[model samples]
Target chain A: MRDIIVVAGKELREIVGAGGGRKGLVRELLFIGIFGLLFPLTQVEAWLSGGVPAAFALMVPLFLVGPHVADSFAGERERGTLETLLATRLPDRSIYFGKILAVCGYAWAVTLLIILASLLALNFGADVSGRGGSPTAGSGESEFFVYPAFVWVAWGVGSIASGLLLASIGTFVSLRSKTVRGAHQAMMIPLFVVILGGSFGIPALFRSLPPSTQERFTELLESMPAVSVVLWAVGGLFVIDLVLLGLGARLFRRDRLISD
Target chain B: MTLAVHTEGLSRRFDGVTALDGLNLAVPTGSIFGFLGPNGAGKTTTIRLLLGLLEPSSGNAVVLGRDVRRESQAIREQVGVLLDSDGLYERLTARQNLDFFARVARLSKGERDARIRALLEEIDLWDRRDDPVADFSRGMKQKLALARAFLHRPSLLFLDEPTAGLDTPAAVGLRSELVSLAREEGVTVFLTTHNLLEAERVCDRVAVIRQGKLLAEGPPEAIRGGGKRKLEVTATGIRPALVARLMNTPEVIGADVDSEGRLILALADGAETAPLIRLMVETGVEVSEARIAEASLEETFLALVDEDLNGRSRVESASGEHPR
Candidate 1:
């Protein structure tokens, strides 16, 4: 556990901390500002109800994790550090798990922070618009504005699960890729497939369903609470995350990692 | 003396190409043993195998009293390695890189701090410890990598071409440090290099390898003195007849005139040079100078590698296949 954390700590510093330099920090801040402030401010109702905001949120990890996770193994190899890492006394599992955990943890933190900031921004905008009926206001009582407990919890868990899933996939790609650019290129297709398929393909398929079938599906969705669906999705993504991590571990051969 | 490493018939093959073949060696504890080989002569492969980063194709060996095939991790824990690559994290500061490896080595926080400081100071990099490694020069990076390898103070060290890229001063400095490290710390070092002079000066024992085969293994003097000593006499009155007579004599293995018209005699083992000089003088040759010198390691190494190449070429031509 200590070894894993030590490795993760170094990795986090490299990807997000002072080691990332001014350009990296500025790029990350820009990304956060655009997604967490601009997008949410432009679509206050949809951000609260969850449609375009949710899709944008999911897309955030894909873009952020793509560069960070690709650098996990492939970057080390390119920089001639992987062999030394392998030669260390740290267990193979520590190095593998440490990199995955670090990348996922960073992506997860950024995603959650964006979501919270967007929520706060939306609420502040509402209050400024005089929609939040404050008791001090001459008009009556200002309604307290908050996303339901279920929505916050569901989004938190689901966002983390989604980050882990994508990061794990990126880990596998990075482990096999000879260069960081190669890993990034390899991840693009699968990432786009997941983003486009989950957003447009699956929903379009549901729309194409027979009216009776669509009604039954709506009934099923209605029968299940939103929290339950969120939990189910998070749980499913977590399982896939585990499988991808396992596959990554299995493929992390020291010889193969260093050899061409 | 206790053996630090022992290998018998340890070999490795990559696809159809043999990288190491029938390597048998025993390195004494606390000795600086040099593994001399050319670029493609499998020095790195041998180190990887001994470190258990590689499995042998047909044979096995023991390192630090444990089987390399089964107890590689145990061996690794007790050994330090510096390969051809300087494995330093570029983005991390020098202190951070050492800290990370020290953590992996499971050093206590107190010990880690002390060791990192001491090593950095010793290598003269303490002032720049906080600087990113990417900002370092190649020699500086190499020095840091060397420091990292011994940061844990392992009982055995494997250094592959440790001084390959450094300028003369840096190489000499590092070499002296290595000598002191071995002597003071009692660490057995297995260093590989093609620098014959460096091996002669720094290594207690040396092994010459070519084409994945062991050519010779012994102390520097012994390897240099392996064959007959040659005596060169700078005389103005040498005769062709005397040269022929010297070549036929049992004491003289061969005789020839060098490009400078000096008498070069390949004397048999334990042959006296005084008698040869007297005989030359009696034969009306003015012996201005007579010098007997042992063959240098460079000469021996070149001769062995050339012989191996010639033998390979012969076999390849007969089989109609070029050797890799």
Candidate 2:
């Protein structure tokens, strides 16, 4: 157990000190800048019905989770540090968890910065628009934007769990690949599939319903409990992540140290 | 007796081709045992198996009295390994690399700093301790590797082709350090190399392996003495009569004239050198020189490998003649 902590600490220090930490921060800043422009240009108020905060909340998962997940193991294997990591006396599970934790830490930091920037942008825009005085189309109605409390808690929990699941999957793929390009190429397939399913397939499935059926489906989605649904999805992903981590540990052969 | 490393019928095969075949090796504690073999002779495979990096197909290995497979973590904590390539993080400075490994090896903060300082000094890299390892030369990298291997002061060390690419001075320095480590610190070293001369210089005992089998194993002198012995005699004004007189000696098994007109004798008894010298001088043959031609370890190794190859072929040919 002591060895595990020592190894994990060393890995964490390497991730932070070896320029990955700085690069991740830079990436986070770039994400903020891009989203900062796109939010107002797309007139997020129209899309969200004066609920710009909810649109920003959805963007948080997309911007922070993908790069953090990809960089966790694929980046280490590219830098030849993976072999050095496996050489330590730490158990495989410890290394796996340590890497996951490091990725989650980076993702959380980035997400926090994004949330803060989004909130600042929204307030600054509102201030410039004369204290919400201009009566837009949906201005009189109460907007159901993601509240600050909900955004903080939900992003924190969802990013951590999602980052871990993706990191573990990335690690397992990295262990099986010899080159960084190969691992990254293999890892992107699943990400692409997820994006395709979320963007096109889900909306198409909803569109296939009749107008009456669609109204009923919308009512059902609105009535569903958010916490329970999020819990089920996050719990299922966490279980899958643990299994993949175990598989990664089993495949972490010491001989690959020399072969790499 | 406590053995630093012991293997019984250790075998490893890849895709039905055996890399190491039923190898049994025992390295005594505190002995610098040299594992000598040619290229593709399973030296690396044996080292990997002993270190638990490669799983043996048939047998087991015990390192420092712990099962290599079952207790690899325990064994690894007590053993230092230096493979052919220096496995290091190139982006990190020399001090950082050592300190990182030292911490993982569980050295305290103070111990880690002190050892890193001492090892940098020992390797003559104190001034460059803060420089990234990527800027270091091959020799300097090798020195750092040696330092890393001894960071935790492991009792047993496995070095695979440690000095293969080193210059003369660097090789000599590392060899001296290794010898001193075994003699002074009582650290048992398992070294594998193709350089017979280097092995002859530093190793107390060597095992010559070929085709995944042990051909000959002993001290250099014992192996050199085991092969056929030759005697050379130089004489001025030696006639046929002088040659006949030398041949009449019971110890002279056969005699031949060389291209230089000097007589060479094959001795049946190596212990009769004194009598032969006396006989040559007393016969008025003006004996200028008399010395036994000592066989070298290389010669012994070649002879053994050649013999084994010939034996295998003969067996194959004979088996072909059988009905089955």
Candidate 3:
């Protein structure tokens, strides 16, 4: 555990702390501005709604994790630092796991921070518009207009799951990539394909379903509490994460890495 | 003497291309052992196999009394390595790089701090310890890497071409530091290099390898003096008849006229030079100088490699392959 944390600490410093310097912070600020402030401000009603905000929040980890993991895994090989790392006394599992943990942790932190920022932006948007119902106005009688409790649970859990998913996929791509640029290029294509397919294919498949079946599905979904569905999704994601990390473990042997 | 590293019939083959052939060696503890080989020789492969970064194809190795196959992690805990490249983290400050490796070696926080400071000061990079490695020159980076490798105070170190590509002064400085480290700390160093001069200067023992096979292994002086006697004759106006007569002399085993009109002769044991000079004088060769001297490490290495290649060629011609 100490080895893992020590490795992760170095990684955090390299990717998000002083080692990354101003550019890393600037990238995070840009991400926060777009996802946390601008998007939420433009769609206050959608932000409160369950569906769009969940997708919106998932994007934060989806975008952040790929670069971090690709650089952390493949960059070490390309820059030749992995050789020295492998020559150390640390276990291979500790080293590999530590890298994955850092990327996921950083991405998840940024994801949660963005979610909180969006909430503030939404409430602040209300104040800016001189809306009287927001709790931020400091009157106890005023009610807070926020996303429902179920949505909060989905946003937090779903973003974490998304971060883990992206990190796993990045590890797989980085295993064969000789350079970080190659890993980045390889990661970007699949992400775009998933984004495009999820955007177009899911709706098309729903539309293709028989009208009666579609109505029954919608009815069944609406009748279930949002939190129950979220729990199920989270469970599914957790299993997938385990399987992917297992595959990574099988391939991440120290000898094999050096040979490759 | 106790052995720090021992190998018996160690070999590694990649896709039917043998990178390292069956080899046997033993390196004494607390000695600077030089692995001398040209490019494409199996020096790196041997290092990897001994370090257990590579598993052998046929035989096994024991490092620090632990089988590399079963106890590579344990071996790694007590050893340091420097590759051909510096392999430093460019974005991290020099101190951070050392700190990270020190953490891996499980040094206490206080010890790591003091060690890092002392190493930086020793390498004359203390003022720049806080600077990111990418900002430093290659020489500075190499020095910091050396510090990192020594951070845990390992009893043994594997340094692969640590002085390659450095300017003369930097190479000299690094070599001196390496000597000091080994001597002062009682460290056993396995240094690999093609720089014969560097090996000659720094190594207590050297093994010459070519085409994945060791040609010779001994102290540098023994290797230089191992073969038959050699005599160099500097003369003007030496005829081919004179060279032929000298080769036919009882004292001379083989003879050649260098491009500069000097005679290089391989001699039998205890062969006197007076007879050879007398022959040269009789053959209308004005002998200016005749001297017997020990061969340099570079000459000995080249001769060893040349002998191996020529022997291989002869075997190929006589049969289908060579066995050594």
- Give each candidate's interface RMSD in Å: 2.0, 3.5, 1.6
Q: Which one wins on TM-score?
A: 3
Which residue pairs collide in model 1, if any?
Answer: A133-A142, A134-A142
lDDT (CA) for every model shown?
A: 0.80, 0.69, 0.80
lDDT of 1 by residue, B1-324 (tens): 888988888999888899999887878889999988788898888888888877789777899899987787788888887888898988888999999889888899999999999999988999999888989999899999999999999999999889987889889998998898789988999999888899999989887777778877778876776646899889887778888877877779988788998778999988877877778889998888899978788887776677778874211211122222
lDDT for residue B35 in candidate 2, whole number 0-100: 86
- Indicate the residue-level lDDT of A95 in model 1: 89
- Stronger candidate by DockQ (2 vs 3): 3
Error of 2 at B87 (Å): 1.2
lDDT of 2: 0.69
lDDT of 3 by residue, B188-272 (tens): 8999987889899998888877778877887787777755678998988777777787778888898877787678998888889
Q: Model 2 Cα displacement at B286 (Å)?
A: 11
Clashes of 1: 2
Which scores higher on lDDT, 2 or 3?
Answer: 3
Superposed model 1: Cα runs more than 4 Å off: A17-20, A124-145, A204-211, A258-260, B167-169, B235-246, B251-264, B278-286, B312-324
The estimated TM-scores of all candidates read 0.89, 0.77, 0.91
Candidate 3 C-alpha error for residue B40, in Å: 1.4
Better candidate by lDDT, 1 or 3? 3
lDDT digits (tens) for residues A39-81 of candidate 2: 6445534422323443344335543455544555566566655
lDDT of 3 by residue, A113-136 (tens): 777888788766744333422224
